[model samples]
Target chain A: MTTVISPPESPAGSPAPRASRGFTFPTRFLPVIATIALFIAMFGVGSFRYEGFSSPQTLLSVLVDNSHLIVLAVGMTFVILTGGIDLSVGSVVALSTMIAAETLRAGWAAPLVIVTVLLTGSVLGLLMGLVIHYFEIQPFIVTLAGMFLARGLCYVISLESIPIKNETFTSFASGTIEIGDYFITPSVIVALVVLVIAAVVLHMTRFGRTVYAVGGSEQSALLMGLAVARTKVGVYVISGFCSALAGLLFSIYTLSGYNLGAVGMELDAIAAVVIGGTLLTGGSGLVLGSAVGVLVLGLIQSFISFDGTLSSWWTKITIGVLLLVFVLIQRLFTRRTT
Target chain B: MRDLGLRFVRHNLFWPTLALVLLLLLNLTKTPDFFSLRLQDGHLYGSLIDILRNSAPTLLIALGMTLVIATRGIDLSVGAVAAISGAVACTYMAGSPDESTAGRAVIGMTMAVAVAVLLGVWNGFLVSVLGIQPIIATLVLMTAGRGLAMLITDGQITTVNNSLFAKVSTGFVLGLPIAILIALAVFAITAVLTRRTALGMLIEAVGINPEASRLAGVRARTITWTVYVFVAFCAGIAGLMIASNTSAADANAAGLFIELDAILAVVIGGTSLAGGRFSLTGTLIGAMFIQTLATTIPTMGIPAETNYLFKAVVVIVVCLLQSPKARAVLSVRRSSPLLTKGSAA
Candidate 1:
């Protein structure tokens, strides 16, 4: 049984024109361009309306605050490109944080803890991929089960938060590289490094092309001799690894691991990915676009904060509205193309 | 006799019923009084009764969910819709000077349901009209509905101390909880409404193949839109019931994760997520199974915090068992030896 990767069929037997060119870039770049435009518009509004919002330090603070989200969205972009989703990422993040904090508290070496958590994340992703691939279960259900398993594991580790006291972790949290008036933390640096690697891999690697092919049409991918199964599984593994890395950064940023941390973060990652111009049906997207999506979300939060009279829940409402608009845009484009 | 028994075992409802029975038996083993019901005044009291009462909200939501799923659409926003319903109802009631009146309660409930219906229409429009994917379409509300709820409550847990409102959930009717009675009424109406008309068949056809069904003059858009509205209405009532049960509506926590439970109930009831033929009876059994599981977890001495782990394992097992791959292996093993005997004939 095919699960979660069913592309919207063309209206009739006649397929839509697959090759299309816009004025400059390909037609597929429309959504990503729109996302960038939205980000810029929001940034302009913030700069115009709020006194200090346009300052580089304010922009840097947005990055610092949402570095973990940026990493999560990058991972999510990969999965969505394969016409799959990884709902377990948020739970995996919480589980990773709990494991890191507990291990650090037990005086384990920081490097060892980091490696173990990353491996654990990859293994968890591998398990889910096996079940989803071999069993032909829906990715939604499989990742949902993974979500529960990870969240439950978090509770089993400790119902309460565990504070990290390791010197290395503390130093990492405190360490920052200055650039003029703005400073960038280790977490931000890690996030940027991950973004660069993801962009390169997704844009330049054969495996990346395979992911797009599989998402475009699994049957065609198989006929073309691409390793569809491996590509599908690999995307989830990447997501898991990224979630764990993000979790480690989060724990460092907070200096504690709480079971409640990162609740609904998977949704945020999804929102960022979609807002960044990734299609939920998969096939076409950009990692850099997802990074822009993260910034848009961070900017929304920053704007809400700047508007002291507004409730924080407005951030959620705005994201929801933006997600709807993006989805609508996607639908219109698909309708027009098909 | 053997043939009859085998057919029964092979029936779709068999496994879920057996699971529910096993859960009840486990409860009985722990506390013999689990099965014993007693009449107190006009109402019944027992573990079984409690399960029935507690499962009312889920059952109501699942009743609507089964229909939605049958049409190959999922309503992920049910929980959030429920939250919004509760927030609207409670805030309306709380704002009233005389909140205890039956008329005010009716007005509040009507307003909440009206809003929910509108939300449902929006979901339907996105899916059927706009041709957006159901998961993503419903997700818009699933993400923002709670925020809307928080806005309605002004980011506070709105509480109402209305006797009439409280009675909607806690009061008894003919020796049973009103909530249970309402759920049963809804179930009966749904069963009659689907089976007694062509609605059920059309819905199934649409779910099986929307384009083919549309070409067959099934009015797929209308059917899809109706089910979304119905599910939202049910969620609204459930939201009201839950809010009345606590006499408070906490937007953040109200109806949280309930959509998952409702979906699980539908799955457990043997409804395929891929959509096609659906069983409302099976959904009822599945809802009961989940409620019993919830009740059993705490009674079995599992710590409250780690209960979700056990639940996760059980859900996986149930889902795996229903998976075609698992069934294929089991059926292959069972029929392999019999194949030779059959071929000899």
Candidate 2:
């Protein structure tokens, strides 16, 4: 977590820093700006077309419904930033819920079960990171194997859905903070806290800068004396931890742990990351951008329900289109940066 | 003579072949007649044949995947492409009579492959023309292809009762399953196309270093584009075989996770994910190994769900053995597979 680049901060009056201030601003922020604009346009269309769409609760509900996704996207943002992809997040989420449910059924305390689930995910991720590093294997293949391992472990725990009926677990799941008609679940709060922490770590700390550096070019990062291997490994661990946390949030929402739950949720998280103006090739994206991407997806669902005519599959197709546009945008912009 | 014999023993396929044998042996403890083969209705029948039968679709996809992987690109959308193909074919057949004739089935399949080919072109465009990352580029189809399939099928599992259509899976030729024959034919053709021609070397060159290959007058872009199209074509046929097997196209479930299986098969066959230097023969063994494992799980009376767990273990073990670090730890003095095969990579 130590910053390698924070030492010898450029003095405030350094002519180099002052000269380029805001010079690269337009192209750099274009995708995020475009994402925010599209989100607003989509929200505007929904509010105008549907009754009760403009209410405060609609946005609040979007946050609550997609809290797990937001958390997953936050984790995905970290991995994708380092030019690596973790195909295992969705499966890890499933494994976490399976473990949490089974342990609780076996009379384990709430705190004990939660810690166990989180530890299981991190350990699995750590092993994968080790393999990826030591073997000099591609991140794509290593994570694909991890995906299989985690999902298989879920089946090993239980093939059937296990319901969580523990008093504390269910209570926390149903608990909500309110402002009259506007309300939020504890899961949403947790997701937001994760986002803020990730943002700070990514932007305000040296570790975060190192993540971007690694993603930009690992060879250059190594030449610059950064811990490329550690940063690469650390991102996967963070992703695993986030996936487990998202799994907890998801369990609260559904209160049931099914083996097949979140089968393609990894795609959703990756889609959110891409849509939030983050480049798929990595090194240039924002955690907050990913949060907006989640909302864009959530709003599409809201739009579908409001119309009552569009099928659920439209969400996938629409997101794919949006992702295409954003990718093209990022491609064009990154061409400029490089 | 002894040196040549040692080199054969040190071949890339040595371990995977052994692993397949070991897995087959594991089945014997439970099935006792695991290796038994009999002629039934003038057709091959046995656990061994069944393994081949079950793995046909995967073998076909893996054949395509091997080439794509050789080009330093991957097609994660193959499963979705398979689903779409099945949906298209079944929906076409069901649009006709329930007892559709051979022409109906052929036409439906042709249309299905056509659409799949077009989808491949889109993927090729994104990757080769637009300069998008392969993983992200094909991911667009991976996400939308299912929805497209559902749209094609009206979100229904289109069922066709055409006998000729079902024959793709159920029919036999010379006492062998037709599906396996098709897969084998494709495998042979791919070998000839890649190895017999300069195409294979060109692909390896592109994979090893795209910029250098492009500068050396290699048509890197076209080769990349063609490889993707070939994989989608393979996926389309595999999807049709799957639909023919069940006589239905469940857009929701058809070809689900087959991409993972194909990728695993390719890896298990001694093809590195880093791309270049592929072995079709190894893929054949790997696909059979996976299919055998599926049967082995049920025969052992354990929960069938642990199949994924077993697969994960096999993948890890295979990868570890391939790793130079593991090789050093185990003190195997064999040349590194990467160096021995394609040092240019």
TM-score of each: 0.95, 0.94
Tens digit per residue, CA lDDT, model 2, B1-345: 999989988999998998889888988987788899999889989888888888999999999899888888999999999999999999998998644888989999999999999998999999999999988898899998898999889888889999988989888999999999999999999899888999989998888888889999999999999989999999999999999999999988999999999999999999988886788899999998889888889888888888888888888898888877888756534767676557445
Model 2: residue A41 alpha-carbon error in angstroms: 0.7
Cα displacement (angstroms), candidate 2, residue A315, comes to 1.4
Per-residue C-alpha lDDT of model 2 across residues A291-315, encoded as one tens digit per residue = 9999999999999998999988888
lDDT of each: 0.89, 0.89
DockQ of 1: 0.66
- Report i-RMS for every model: 1.0, 1.1
Error of 1 at A50 (Å): 1.0
Model 2 misplaced stretches (Cα beyond 4 Å): A1-27, B1-5, B332-345
Task: List, residue by residue over A14-93, the lDDT tens digit for candidate 1.
Answer: 44446423332556677888998998899899999989888888778889999999999998899999999888999999
